[model samples]
Target: MKKLTMALIALPILAIGTTTIAGMKYASDDDRCERGERYSQEDRQKRNPDKMVERLAKKLELSQTQKNEVKQLFINKQQQRETMREQMQSLHKTLRGLDPSAADYASALAQAKQKAAFMAESKIDERMHMKAAMQKILSPEQMAQFEAMQSKRKHHQGMER
Candidate 1:
């Protein structure tokens, strides 16, 4: 009778512990793409890219070929972003050397701005490419759903600020 009573008492504790651990894992995974703590390329490669492909495939009902193409597109975009970030870092270093108020500083600043603009353009192109790739994979309804989700996310972000 004592063993039975102890087992019943321990059961709820074990269930609650399991629930807490599972909830923490889910929260961490869901917030991987959040700003400020955005996942690095290595982390994305390890956890996100494949998971995204899988989830998107399930959500969009993608075929195997489409999934493959979308995955490649994502990988390419990730690489391009890494390259753009490196270019931005290099340009920042150049900007740091020039005196902000000097006559020559205008030309230096212009050059830096040009480089920054190019980087931004590159990222825009990458986004377009990824969207195009996704379009090939997702049905019209699924595409609309994805767009709605993106819009909602942006709105929520704006609200948070």
Candidate 2:
């Protein structure tokens, strides 16, 4: 009787846990994307330039001048990305007005691709600028250290997979 009662209790607990997991799996993708946990602009600013410079300075053992220059570079890149995001959002809004089955769909898709290409170009430009700025700020030895750190991070990420 005790074994049967214990099994009855365990069965409901397992069923409840499985149901919770299944419900999460079936939840709306849009609802997940637009959830209340989204970061605000203020949160983004707090996370950028200033926080990045502090972290990089510790990792690279940067001088005051190098830290200042790196921070400025990060700020400029962040602003450029924000502008690109706005342009992309506008293009997406325009694309949304066209019917998916219309002949204009091809033209709309082409414009969307152009916008995506522009954003990608801007990202590459930002990365190049960052590399150049880092090169100017860091010594050869420091650059080696940075590369090693990046490699370790990549390896750790791969292990997680």
Candidate 3:
């Protein structure tokens, strides 16, 4: 009877502890970068593609095919994002290497501005493509759930800001 009583008491405490831990948000890579800190290994692993797909599959009750499709989609998105990131880095390098005293400074600056705008547009294009592809891939119910999840995430992110 004493053991039973202790177990009952411990159960609720354990539940509370787990709930609190689950509710806490950790810093993302972008947040760490903006704060001039490095992303910890744990955070990097959290963003791994397989981990993300597994989480989504569990949340949405995805079938094997859906899981594979979503995983591929994520891979494609990451590749496209990396390409854009490389371009942005190159643009920054170009601007940084330019001599302010040089006559071509203004022209280089103008070219950089154009590239920046193009990158911004490319981002929008990627977003639209992803949305369209997801709509085609996810069923109505899953799409609704996915959109709701996205909305909640955006809301939480906005509150952080």
Give me the candidate number with maximum TM-score.
2
Point out the higher-scoring one by lDDT: 1 or 2.
2
Which wins on lDDT, candidate 1 or candidate 3?
A: 3
Superposed by TM-score, candidate 3 places the C-alpha of residue 119 at a distance from the truth, in angstroms, of 0.7
Candidate 3 lDDT tens digits, 6-25:
99999999999988886553
Q: By the lDDT metric, which is better: model 2 or model 3?
A: 3
Candidate 1, 1-161: lDDT as tens digits: 99999999999999999999877764764566545675566664674567778987886787898788878877777677677778887988998888977888888888888988888887788778778877877788989988887778889889534
- lDDT of each residue in 99-154, candidate 2, tens digit only: 88888898888888888887888789878877777778789998889778877988
**In model 3, which residue pairs have backbone atoms overlapping below 3 Å?**
none
Clashing pairs in 1: none
For model 1 the local lDDT of residue 38 reads 55
- Return whichever of 2 and 3 wins on TM-score: 2
Local distance difference test values of all predictions, in order? 0.79, 0.81, 0.84
For each candidate, give its TM-score against the true structure: 0.64, 0.71, 0.70
Which stretch of 10 consecutive residues in model 1 shows the poorest summed lDDT?
26-35
Better of 1 and 3 by TM-score: 3
